[model samples]
Target: MTFFSCRPDTERRKVFHLLSFLFLAGFLLIQSFAAHAALVRIKDIADFEGVRTNQLIGYGLVVGLHGTGDKLTNVLFTRETLISMLNRLGVNIRDREIQLQTHDVAAVMVTADLPPFSHGGGRIDVTVSATGDATDLTGGTLLVTPLMAADGEIYAVAQGSLATNAFSARGAAASIVHNIPTNGHIANGAVVEREVPVDLANRKQMHLSLRNPDFTTAGRIAQAINGSLGSNIARVMDPRTIALDLTLRDSIPALSRIGDLMVEPDTLAKVIVDDASGTIVIGNDVRISTVAIAQGNLTIQVTETPMVSQPGPMSNGTTTVVPRTSINVNNGNNAKLGILRNGPALSDLVSGLNAMGVGPRDMISILQAIKADGALQADLEVR
Candidate 1:
C-alpha cells in the first residue's frame, strides 16, 4: 500500500476511453436502424411518371329540358349549334326557325380525364356545364360530341343523359333551388375513340414522382427498394423523384414488387391555422420549447335609451326627445401565468392548452406569440 502504480494508471485510462468510444458507436448504429423501422409502400409516396391522366374537352349541346334552356335571342351560339345539329340529321333546318324553337337546348362544354393505357371503346365519365346563361340543366340529355386533346386531335365521343345534384321548382311568384343547376355529370358517357401511345416496356428506366416532396422520404424509399431487391435497383435522383432501371423481360412484375415494398418516411413539423373558420391543425411531431404565456379577455359595453317629453294637456309646447347613454369596461384581472418549462409532443401540448379553455382562434394568437419569441419549433401558416 506504500507504492503508487504509474504504468497501471495510464493503461487503465486508455482502456476507459476505448470503451466509451465503442459504446457511443454502438448507440448511434442502433439509432440509425431504428429510424428505418417504420415502413410505407412506395406506391403511396410516388406515382409513375408516364402512367398519368390526360385531359379531354369538347363543346356540346344538352337537350330535352322543360323550357329551362338558354334563350335563342340572347345566346346566338345555341341557335347556330342547333341548326348545325339538325342539318347533320338531314332535316335542313334554317337559322330563323331555330331562333323561335331552340329554347329546349343549351350549349355545354364537356370535360373528362383519360387515364393511362385507356384503349379504344373504353368508357369514361364526363362533366357537362353550360357555357351560356342557362337557368337549369336538370333532366337533359347530352348530344353526341367529339372530345379533343390539346393537339386538336379527337380522342373520344360523349353522349348520355345528365345527372345533376341540383333541382329547381318555380311557380309564378316564388322559386326554390338546391345545389348547382347549370352543371351535371354523365357516368360512363364518353367512349374512347383513339388511344394515346405509351411504351412502358421499352423504356430504359421508370421514374416515380412524389405527391409531397421530401428528401428524407426519397432516400428511405431508395434504400428500401435496394434492400428488398437484393441489388442497387432504385436510387433517389432528387427530393421528389426516384429512378429505377427496367432492363428485364418482367419489368411489370418488378415494378409491382417495388410497389409492394415499404419504407419509413421522414416528415417536417407543421402547423396550419384558418382565421375565418377558427380551425387549427397541428402535426404530431410538432414540439414547443419552454416559455411563459398569459391570456385574458377584455369586455366593453355601451347602451343608449331615448326619453320622450310630451306636451301638457293645455300647453302647446312640442314634444322633445333626450338620449341617455351608459358605458362600462371590464378587463379580467385574474389571468394566471402559464409556465411551459419543457418541450412536449403535439398531443400533450394540445391537452395542456385545452385544460386552460383556449379556443382555436385564440390558440392561433398564442402560437404566433410563441413563434415570435423563438419557442415554437415548427412552421406556422395562417390562412
Candidate 2:
C-alpha cells in the first residue's frame, strides 16, 4: 500500500523558480568562459613578411599665411627655397639685387607613407610640418613637392591646401593657441608615380611574422594553420617566424585561407607596473607562490606656525618673532600583514592583495618585493 501526497501551489512554484535560476546561472558561466578563451584571427596578430609601407619624405613650402610665415631675413633656407622655386618657374629672382621680403610663405618638411603594392596615379595623404620659426600654417597651400623614399627615388608628388585644424588669437600682451599651429595634414595630397614591385604570386614560399613573439603562440599558430589546410604545410621556424609551404597550393589563395583561420594564442606570465601613472596590469597566466606581504611607507610631516611677540603696555620689552614647528612621524604600525596562498589563478592573487587595503602603487611595491623573494612566478616590468 502507498499513500498519495500533493504539495501546495506555493511550494511547487518555489521549486520551479529554483530550477530556472540554476539553469540561467550555468548558461552565463559557460558564456563568460567561452568569451575569455575566444580565438583571434591570424591577420590581427601576425603579418606576412615583405609586406610593409615605405616612409617618404620631402622638403616643401607652405604659402598664403596671414603674416605668420617664416621671416626671410632670419631663415636663410626659406629665402633660398623661395628663390629656387621662383627660378624653376622662370621668374629668375636670383639675379635681382633687391631684398626679397614676404611673410606669406613658410618652409616645411612634407612626409608620407607609400603603402605596399601602391600603383601609379593612386593618391595618398601627406603631412606637412614647419621647419622654421613660422608661427602658424593655417590657410596655407603646399606647393608641388616630390616625395622620396629611402633609396632617393621620387615616388610621389604632393600639392594640396593644408588643414592645420588649429587656431591662434593674440592681442598686444597675450595670445592663445589651440592645438599645434605649425603642423598640418592634407588628405589625398600626393599621387603615386611608381609602384613598389612585389611578385608574391610567383614566390615559392612565404613567411609569417608574429608581432609579439612567443614560443607557445608560434606552435599554436603552426598547428592551427596545418589543421585548417593540411598536414605539415605550416612549420614553426622560430618564436617569431612561421614558414608556409606553397609548392602544393596557390600562393595567394593559400595565404588568404590561412589568414582567415583562427587560433588561440598563449602569452607569457607577466606583470607590468607604470609608476608614473600608478597603473598595474596583471596577466591571466601570472601566478604567485605562498608568500606573506605587508606594504607601508614611513612618512614625516613638519608644520611651521610663526607668532609675533608684542611689547607689553608699560614694559621695556621689544617686539620679536617666535617660530613654532610641529613634527609628526608615522611608521605604519597599523598596517596589517596579508597572506597570499599558492594559487593557479589571477583572482586569488588580486583578492589577497586587495584584502590588505592597498592601492595600485603600493601593490606595485609588493609585487616587486615578492619577485625579489622568489615567490612571484612571473616577470615583473616596472616603468
Which tens-of-lDDT digit does each residue in 293-336 have in candidate 1? 78887979999988998999999899999888899887967777
Report RMSD (Å) for each prediction in the order shown: 10.9, 4.4
Worst 10 residues of 2 by lDDT: 1-10
lDDT of 2 by residue, 206-235 (tens): 899999998898998999888888988889
Q: Estimate the TM-score of every prediction.
A: 0.81, 0.84
Q: Considering every candidate listed, which one attains the maximal TM-score?
A: 2
Evaluated at residue 215, the lDDT of candidate 2 is: 87
Query: Model 1 TM-score?
Result: 0.81
